[model samples]
Target: MQAQAFAPRLIAWQALNGRHDLPWQVNDPYRVWLSEIMLQQTQVSSVLEYYPRFVTRFPDVQQLAAAPQEEVLALWSGLGYYSRARNLHRAARMVVDAFGGRFPETREALETLPGVGRSTAAAIAAFAFNARETILDGNVKRVLTRVFGVEGWPGERNVEKALWTLAESLLPEDAASMPAYTQALMDLGATCCTRVRPACTRCPFAADCVAHQQARTAELPAARPKKVQPTRYATLLLACHGGRVLLERRPPAGVWGGLMSLPELPAGELSEAWLAQLGTGEVLPAWPEFVHVFTHFKLVITPQPVEVDALAPRAADDTRQWLTPEAAIEAGVPTPVRRLLEALSSGTLSVSHQIST
Candidate 1:
């Protein structure tokens, strides 16, 4: 049988038995878009709880557009990659202002919005607008590269272009089923043609997979190039006054921005006088050391505990808030910051000052 004709049947098999009941699965594009954004650099299990809450808060494009940036950022707290939240907020406003509070009707228009990349745009276009297009997310990329036995690492200019072209070529033109078909491919790639291990026996595309036929399934897509990651050091100041902990909101540009976090690196170096100003007492020596890894860098954080009568301007640009341990947790701090706060509150961790080296 020709590959072209068999493709839909393969996907149909997947649709009937493959696609899981994702939170945004129904015909609601706003929910779909929300889930897709949260799913970036995050997992299904992680996204599950966040997705429903996001939709409940925003519900539609108009609601998201009208929301305050802080509220949006707060809703997006745990999901890292703060820029995605910012962009989603920006895009929502744009959609409301430019598109009459409606999600763009087509992939091209959707792509013009902030944070909506090609695959994301394609998804919105298909699942939302029922456009006949294919989406090549990471899962789809792996599945396509392995099934067709395409070569070269992903993102290589020619290889990526070829993948996109192949993706377009495989998409069924029938508008009625295009949306389901697109999602079906994603479902198959995520569930069956998985990264660590593939379930060939259950995969509908197995019979026609070129790599599988040749016993080269694992070797089809060339391994990606790797580079060494650099490490950086930072200082975090933990302050407590009368059962309240000091938490500062990060600026909206870098990592964990807009989330409530520890007062960090208030100045070039901590001084005894500077410590006396943040709360009711004096600055103590740096005590605990913690290491955390982000996507691009490893951070070694040295925590300093300071007590003062009233929180002051630790630096030219720092604002301080005092809250109970439970209140701080509800204030949108990321995992690392929240974890540290929890440890401090539970007496499992203690406060001190600067690591000499």
Candidate 2:
């Protein structure tokens, strides 16, 4: 298909078949920005549940900027990648301070925000401001890769550069079409050109898609090179006292940053030394070990539930709290931690007999 024909065809298709009722489709950049951040590495269905609640809690840039980071993190709980929420909070304050609570209209200026990257900035600009900016998000990457038959993993620097070039080449000449055009690219890739078992016949690009024509749909977007993922082991201390669990705020960086989590004991740490902070407690049977996979490594977590008569006075500090499982679930805990809390609150804690190596 001619580069000139791409935008018009996509825009037409999107007008009729694209998702139109998403809560964030409003022209307000704040809503657009929130949806964009929440949608990162998250499914639309998940965002559908969180986005409305988020907007209802913090309606605008000024409101989000003024809200406490803890509230922001709490609202963002269960949405993995807590850094996005942290950056979002920081970015909201930055926008309030730097731009008088208004989102920058241009993509270049928008990229300067904490969590808003190139594609995010472009989408915000195009959808919110009708700016003619090209977006090369994951969906667009997949679409371009298969339709153009681009070889090599998109994560590779050189391959990404080529995809960006192709993306820029297909931008709608009219700025007015930017929103529809960008959404079309995303919708096409997400709904039709899925990563697995794509609906080739339903795709508008089926006639011109190199992957479909060449029968290489499965292999067109090359997969990432494999590597042996290393596992890190830790014991999560689920110390219980009077029906409340001891939780600590993780440091503001690294895994589960700035979120409340069960106190962790690394593999080589001494139990007696670690217990010095928590005082004496009766150790219960260990829960079944489970693996939480990160992007680069696997975290082998063993939940060690302990029945403590009382916590050390020093244990309850600004960074630590003893909350009922009900309250902890509502706090900013990681997904795995939340699951454990849910099981504990629901009175379904089953001790696993055989621990995985």
Candidate 3:
């Protein structure tokens, strides 16, 4: 139960059992920072698919900062919680503008960057600078809560504060072991002390874990309280002309922030007005209705495909574009939008009903 004993056991166990080959486990802060941001609210398996492509495209802070936001969002299309991608781009600019294209080496400075929080900052500090700092990320939170039998939801401020205190108390005196110690905590929580069906028998802290001793490993880390998510409606205009479709870039905030998507009609607005605004188009048919659930609400999207004879010329802006269906699919669109566009282009869009408007 002593603070000093925790890190050594974790570090020793990590040497033989921890993940050693993750793409972002290197000593470089840029890679570490990118991985941390991507891993937020996303599983390791999903992050693996995007991490390599992202690094290969951007390479470093300077390149990432210099690249267009659309390109960055395109690379990050499928990964949800898109605000993380936006913040990653914004933070890269901050690092370049303030730190001369170098990632800050200290926890305080790192925390000042967009999307990098306390735990993320500590991780970068420990791995990149070899600084003795503690990280209380989700994995570490689970590990610490179970080992010490901390009772209450980790989201609660008091519980979080206590965990942070415990985390700092358990920091290893030897700075050299920071990386292994940090990674060990993450590995243990993710692979062993999982949220469901934890492998308590193989845990190194089994004998000392208060939750295991009390037969309450499953109940120690309390779950977040659930709330009812309200439903919302949207009408997506799949306006097309010959081989191309109309796509619009969303504002830099809100749902699907900064991503390219099919032009949307305002709530309670008729499809005919929107079609007239764009160009002379005939409203063909309605595609199948689908629902996309966000963290706070459910969106019911009604897809109205309009075949345009001509597109009215408007002042050019970065927010609107007309591209071939294939290119639209390749652009940074939400998953649902991508699916509809793909179906539209391939002549496979299922027609559920005809739209006269």
Find the candidate with the highest TM-score and give its number.
2
Q: Against the true structure, candidate 2 has what lDDT? A: 0.88
TM-scores for all candidates? 0.62, 0.64, 0.64
Clashing pairs in model 3, backbone N/Cα/C closer than 3 A: none
Candidate order by TM-score, highest to lowest?
2, 3, 1
Please, what are the lDDT tens digits per residue for candidate 3 over residues 1-357? 888898898898999989999989999999999998889888999999999999999999999999999999999999998888899999999999998889889999999998899999999999888888899888888989989999999999999999999999999999999999999989999999998889988899999999899998878798886787898888888888878888999988988899999987758244556766776767776777777778788788888888888865644786788888789888878987887777887797683333211
Rate residue 228 of model 3 by lDDT. Answer: 76
Off by over 4 Å in 2: 228-357
Candidate 1 per-residue lDDT, tens place, 1-357, comes to 354764587567766776657768878777878877887768888988788888888888888888899999998898899999999999888888988877877888888989999888888788878897678888888888888889899779899999999888887757878777887887777778887668889887688888788888778677887666687777887787767788888888898877788867745367566455553576766757767777798777777776656655445544557787779999778776777777778875563333221
> How far in Å is the alpha carbon of 168 misplaced in model 2?
0.4
What's the true lDDT of residue 8 in model 1? Answer: 80
lDDT of each prediction vs. the true structure? 0.78, 0.88, 0.87
Q: Which candidate is the best by lDDT?
A: 2
Q: Number of backbone collisions per candidate, in order?
A: 12, 0, 0
For residues 1-357, could you state the per-residue lDDT of candidate 2 as single tens digits?
799898998888888879888889889999999999999999999999899899999999899999999999999999899999999999999999999988999999999999999999999999999998899988899899988889999999999999989999999999988988988998998888899999988888899999999999889799998887998999988888888988889999999999999998888243987676777878888888887878889888888888887866744366888899989888879988887887788776763433232
Better of 2 and 3 by lDDT: 2
